[model samples]
Target chain A: MTQDSRTNSIVINGLNDSAFKVRLNRNLEIIQSVLANPTTVIGLVIVILMLMMALLAPVITEPNMPDPYQMPRDWQAARSAPLTPGHVLGTTNRGGDVYYGVVWGARTSLKLSLIVVCLTVVLGVTIGSIAGIVGGKVDEVLMRIVDVFLSIPELIFALAIAAILGPSFTNIILALVVVFWVKYARIMRAQVIRIKQRDYVDAARIMGDSKIQIYLKDILPNSFSPVMVQATLDMGNIVLVGATLSFIGLSEAGIAEWGVLVSEGQAGISAGRWWASTFPGLMVFLWALAFNLVGDGLRDVLDPRTETKR
Target chain B: MSSADKTILSVKNVKKHFPIKEGVFQKVVGQVHAVDGVNFDIKEGETVGLVGESGCGKTTIGRCVAGLEALTEGNIYFDLPSDKIALLEDSEKQDDKKVSAEQIEEIGNSYDIGKIEGDLFNHYRRNCQMVFQDSFASLSPRQLVSDIVSRPLRVHNVCPENEVIPRTINLLEQVGLGAQHLYRFPHQFSGGQRQRISIARALALDPKLIVLDEPTSALDVSVQAQILNLLHDLQKKRGLAYLFITHNLSVIRHMADKIVVMYLGKVVEAGNTEDIFANPQHPYTKALLAASPDLQSEVTSGMAALDGAIPDPARPPQGCSFRTRCPVAQPECGWEVDDVVRRLEHKDSIFNFLKEVDQSDAFNAKFTFETEAAANQLMAAMKSDDIPDAMKKMVSKLNCDAEHVTVSFKPAKTVPLIACGNGSSARCVLVNK
Candidate 1:
């Protein structure tokens, strides 16, 4: 009987080729939907440009050797104005180059957001998976802990933690890491809880797949889109929060950070040396706006309600 | 198409009760008796159709058979040898010659899906698979057709690494889908095509028993026939036993060799399909057959759709569970004080003034009313035509004292499934007589 059925089937040649084509088409469809929105395209372009600027920071401007992140001070160019010869966009009161600050500020912002987002996403997913899967007392206890973390306002919580750890760039990163992870934990827990009940997970269990296999293959992958969207949004949020913390004098003075440069430039605002503050501040606004637009577009595209359409 | 008398799965008085919890401390207030002492057997390569209305515990029984749920009571023996099955049945009968305890223990350790461990449990897992109702939800949205169908083989290492793809394509082909259908997500397929994929996945491991939990319920009628035909062809080729669960009697009549009718977590009737369809002994089964629209039947007004919803499974009525809605209910059909309360609770005027009920047992209870007039109203209601004649006849004692009305019923025992001579059983007083 099996032989008869096999003979009846029209076996196509180049099985792998067809399989590859199907996968490619599915991926292309996802990409097309994600790029359909105009706002998302604008966000994508700005994000790419910002990323390029960050990557080429050292190549675009000579590094301040020994400590590249430390702004180079030139007493001769002190308080220079916009488009001044050899000092475009002028310099701060202490002669920190505005052009250098703007370029390097992207690198700083990217580092802070990427590191915090990565660490927090991993931490949050781990805790949330444990809570959702283990449930019972562990779920109850972990959710209470998450609720405590969520109760406090995000910015103030990051500020207090950074303050307690003392003023430094590393400490601000640590504070943001601590503050941002709880939301991921909350989102992942909810997602895991929802996905674990899906019939495929039950089917996997019925097939005698190991618990870890079910979690990694069935639950995690299905539950990950929302987390992906959250991570993208947090790429913007983490920087905004970190910059705010830095602007409040939590970070060391004169670092090549956007928030520190904005603070330094604010002091000279009354004296008409606006280029110092304006350039780096504009970079911060663009960074946050680009990611926000992209995140909103992603939320619309990857929304679970519409996920089946693809 | 069934093989010689070999039992593939035997569900012996299985019960699954889920706890209803409340409050921060998660207190167990009560239990919903989802599957209460249900028993049936599926022979090798036979289809046992479990037919019931929605929430009749058909799906729960299916889940238990697939080993997806832990049974709160009783055992499900999977792939038990014929000799061991006979011994187990004899032991259950408790005849003069009893099977030894050690032999029973041996059979349980080897055959019971719940008690078996390690290699034996894995063997059971490989042999039993499930195809769920919602095709869209059952197949993983993230998985391609190749991954979904090939998953069981990979999990069980049923074949070598290199042969997984060929074997997957073969499985897909057997389900009427070719290799071109592989590598696509579940969302890309039509409902019937998705169901075909699900069947292909279930067929991957070449399971001995497949639990079809309303597998074609979500498909269009035309698509449903195609899937059912595909299932029949696959079964014929593979010699697979199926626990076919569905509420559609017409579908069951087409697919099942034997049928088990259930009502409120208990089997109301069980027999060969032709016998049950020709002469349904249980009232619920009769009502179901009457309600189903048969094309050959000339009288449309003959439809006897059951009135009243199924009673709460948490507090299932005594005796026959179907007695609440049985048109042919008798005096001995176990009418109790709860029945009186259920009938009169809808009358707001009488119940609003009713304060409490002090009950000694299900058969007896004393009603305390806010006024003597309210107690008289309750007494009048019980004797009125609003109450069934059988229920009124079963009331052994009824009296209205100033502000209290006392009612007592002849205590009825829980009805057991009685054999009716020709390889059939029914849970009804009329059948027993």
Candidate 2:
């Protein structure tokens, strides 16, 4: 409150500012180390390409054109092989442009995986934290339910649910979500059990934080890095599963999905018109691979063990 | 001291027994008596140091006071009304479990914190906070410095929405940290600075009592001094009652006005800091002071070390818990059969000869050794200088046959705390005698 005290405080702040700068520099160094890894760089490039494709999907396609899911058939240009103008990479037996299917499929694929991952994380984390923190009859009941769901093989469960719900985009998402949320829940429960014992959580309780507040604010945030890594890795797996389901005819038939695209061209593959299915199949593989690489990269950066190992 | 100095927290006969369960059924087998019948109080604007060895339950008592752990029995009254205290006393007398929820709610006029429900509990929680031993673990790594300090303010709704950051900055400055350190996470700061942040957070609620659980144990010596000074300055600035828990006597000597020395979950001695240090009637207190080397003490004064570890809290010695290692233990110190085993524990040759024991109680036991000579060896040692004369006098029965020896001490009363001087007490038979 006095001028002398104000000046004294300023001097103290000045002394600490240099130390603060050193810490900032160290943080930047860690970021620099992460970026320096070649795997992370390659992963970054592929991730950027896919992200751009997904983000620019609508602009790249003709919005007013009916049936934007697939290109219109061109009978005159049918069976055109790789590098053919206007229908680059080739034309399918159905005469739809392979490039169009690949481009728009990115949007559908990204959106589906993101929605599924988000739903699984929210549902799983909420349930898992509650089970772990409460730790009694409630924990026993919830965890046993998780165990039952976990015991059922993921694909089998997804197939049964999708079949019962019948084929639709929403139904497919619902099935995938039901199958995937268990993974997040189990991971989150384990994380919550560990973090809840941490001193900071105890401090929060002593600070008068309600049980809900402690879980949401204190325990959940500390457990985020692991959940984020798991989410990233699962995004790729979910997309692959979505594609597999569609290929097996568990998905809506008329969709811009990569798995559907491949199924449509499967008949042409035996007739020596390999471009029909090969290009679409290749797109699916590349999409999964790109996400996997990015996920791996993120893991290396986010995991404290990995950072310490370096 | 005037009547204005009110008691901020009063803990009476607090006990916390953690259930130790085993087997497939997970049935409760035993309980670790973590804080067994401890009592102390913190007056407003004063510091009371809870000094003890690691397993002595100082931290547990702190947690109980901070409302982090429920008391298994007894009461922790926080500025409770006289009528409410009377009601609690009635409930305590009548069968504590049968005390209805309505009674608890009615007694919520003032807090019997462990029993009070809803808003009363939250009020006690907000008014009493804890600063833990480990600063690194106590501050969440994911949170920035500003957010960590501002958390209490935001949780308690101490200020308006827009002023949270500014208030946090002000709190930080009071602890000698400032705007430059705001956005950085806990790991970025030095140990001292992080502890400062913890102090700042504790101060945020304008609490009446702060349970400082070894706030300096994890810090370097110089940093500890700085933090202690900061704490002192803050205490002076705002009339805050502190229950400062630590194992370091010198630190307690410097910071605390009243000192409570605990051993095996029980307070052995407690009094005003100056009086207790000047004349520690409890032998345990004397051993502790002598064990901790002080520069002020003569260099030729050899440190007096206690003989063994703290007894198991699950079954603490049935007498003065310190008697087995007490240098001045006497006949009336409640010598028991457990003491003979404890005495033989350090002498390898004597302990290795004996195998089995048939005991009726802690005070008597029949030992079956390998041969008669080994049994006679213990008897001879008991009379020799190896054992104390006072213990030898308490040996009312000692019989040795071909291979077994039965021994028993004259049953003595369990030592209780006796008043020694003005406001000073000790759990020693000598003081009582």
Candidate 3:
């Protein structure tokens, strides 16, 4: 880099440092609160390990793909059972390694959740903020529209959308995003509506702020708390929705998704071949459970009401 | 442009009435007369204090002037100059008087506040800022003091973005907040400090007319004194005008050069603060001084208070609004049949039983009674001296035909605030009597 470029970077760094220190301090305060609770720490560790497992999927597993219809040629090699070297948790009817499937399933689940969450939070907050700030007949109409979506069962809506969109992991995420955004929009809209009436908004108005300026500067930033808490909690629900869609056969056409593995295990179970479904089912349960625990623990920490409670 | 000669803002007979919505369909029932015909002029480089009880619409008047609320009637004349003030005064002649939007922008750049456009509104906004009552809720907690104070400067392009923090720190210092406080959030500061930051933000625009709307009503007395003194010093240095609104008599006495005492929604008494304080002419003004706990007489005598509660603003008492609560209510104080019933109804069951009252402007009522004895009792009460004598005397006829007592009160015109005893305005019949 040029010397001038380095100087410009330094100037920008100083600006960022000064601008966001308070936000950083508040984030650190949340991190410290999580550290204060041991169960929360354990949940955090589980999440960290899950993240690692998802990231290291290719490195740990065989590069080759498993043949879904391949027979277990060597019975003992297939029935080597859990705790045996290389054959941990035994093998499926297709002779696929259970450990490899677990690693790969973790990757698919995490990636799917991250995509759904990004879509839900971004689209949801924007829609909610507009509905909230432009309050009047528009607010009433938008809220009723949100109310209709929120009233529908999450499972039914996901299923109906997935059915129409056809079975694929991408389609499942799209369906879940559609179903999940309503909650963020509702929480955020309510929060914005409440905060927009506060005296700060009035002060902003008296300061000659236009409606757009008030919405961006006064309403949205102050209304961030409820949306933040909802977002954290909504992660668990989003993951669950993804897994449920996969279980109902809306996963990538033939790839081994956790839910599809569970379905495949159920098909293999009567014949006493339970490894395929059981391992993937445990991965899905553990991921969802970890997210929920972390979300609940973060909620107890990030929530302003809880601070007041203490 | 001369300091001592300019009339900064002229408020004409301003009236603001809020509509009352009632019933299943939510029909526009009637207007709640929040502010009815108020007029006051705020001079350049002077503090004009607006004092009244909580519901007297002092804040409403401030809001109307500040353009927070729309005026239901009347005009607000801003002395923003022909450049700023001249164009807004044009309610007609748009095309002929038309300057291009760009030329209007140039006008904004060249003229005083009353003469400008977009930039002038920005200038007017910066010049005529307001400080709110509740310091606790006024500042946004999530924001840093630097950001909050620098917000106005940024919005109006008062300074370059890089110069913002330095300017903000300077403003913070000006308002008693310092360098150590700039990076802190609103919750990190105490109430007084937060209010100082709010003042700093208001001052960031370098406004000439700061509307301190009960700025000290929500602070500790000592803190209030500090803010008051800061405001005093700032005004002295900047030569600013302030429209100080408060219910606190003592604070208004110390701060205002001219005081406007409001009752119901009208200015009942207005003059130099010394004149109003030394010899409060209006009976309502006397009652306010009597009621102010801080200014109790040293005689240890029971301070004379108005007898009843404030008359309902929805249907404010006719003739004189203060008559219902006046220590000296006269008979011709527009003592209507309703007032006679209101006065007697509370004392006995004679009023408690009557289902409905059908009143007419003809000073008569159709007889509708649950029982005849109740009607007779009402007629008897109207004749008694326990009620106003003028009510008993001016009441031309009382004919109790049956269960309905058709009584007629002498029709009296609504008394205007007329010049009365020793340079005072009295809105009562007896003042002329």
Q: Write the per-residue lDDT of candidate 3 for residues B43-115, one digit (tens) a residue.
A: 8899988988888889888877666777888666666454455554452256556645675555435542333
- Pitting candidate 1 against candidate 3, the one with the higher lDDT is 1
- Which regions of candidate 3 fall more than 4 Å away from where they truly are? A1-23, A63-87, A91-98, A164-166, A250-254, A267-278, A304-310, B1-5, B20-30, B80-117, B298-303, B306-319, B335-433
Off by over 4 Å in 2: A1-34, A58-67, A70-80, A92-96, A151-171, A263-273, A304-310, B1-5, B23-26, B80-111, B117-126, B159-169, B295-303, B324-414
Model 1 chain B is weakest, by summed lDDT over 10 consecutive residues, at: B295-304
Better of 1 and 2 by lDDT: 1
On residues A159-240, what C-alpha lDDT tens digit does candidate 3 reach at each position? 9999999987788888999998888888788788778777788878778888898878878777777667676666666767
Better of 1 and 2 by TM-score: 1
Candidate 2, position B361, lDDT:
86
Q: In angstroms, how far off is A246's CA in candidate 2?
A: 2.7
Q: Give lDDT tens digits, candidate 2, residues B53-162.
A: 89999999999998888889987889865566566667757556666768866655456788777777778877888898888889887667877888988888888865
Ranking by TM-score: 1, 3, 2
Computed on C-alpha atoms, the DockQ of candidate 2 is 0.35
Best by DockQ: 1
Best by lDDT: 1
Ranking by DockQ: 1, 3, 2
Where is model 3 chain B poorest over a 10-residue stretch in terms of lDDT?
Answer: B107-116
The alpha-carbon deviation from the true structure for residue B202 of candidate 2, after best TM-score superposition, in angstroms, is: 1.9
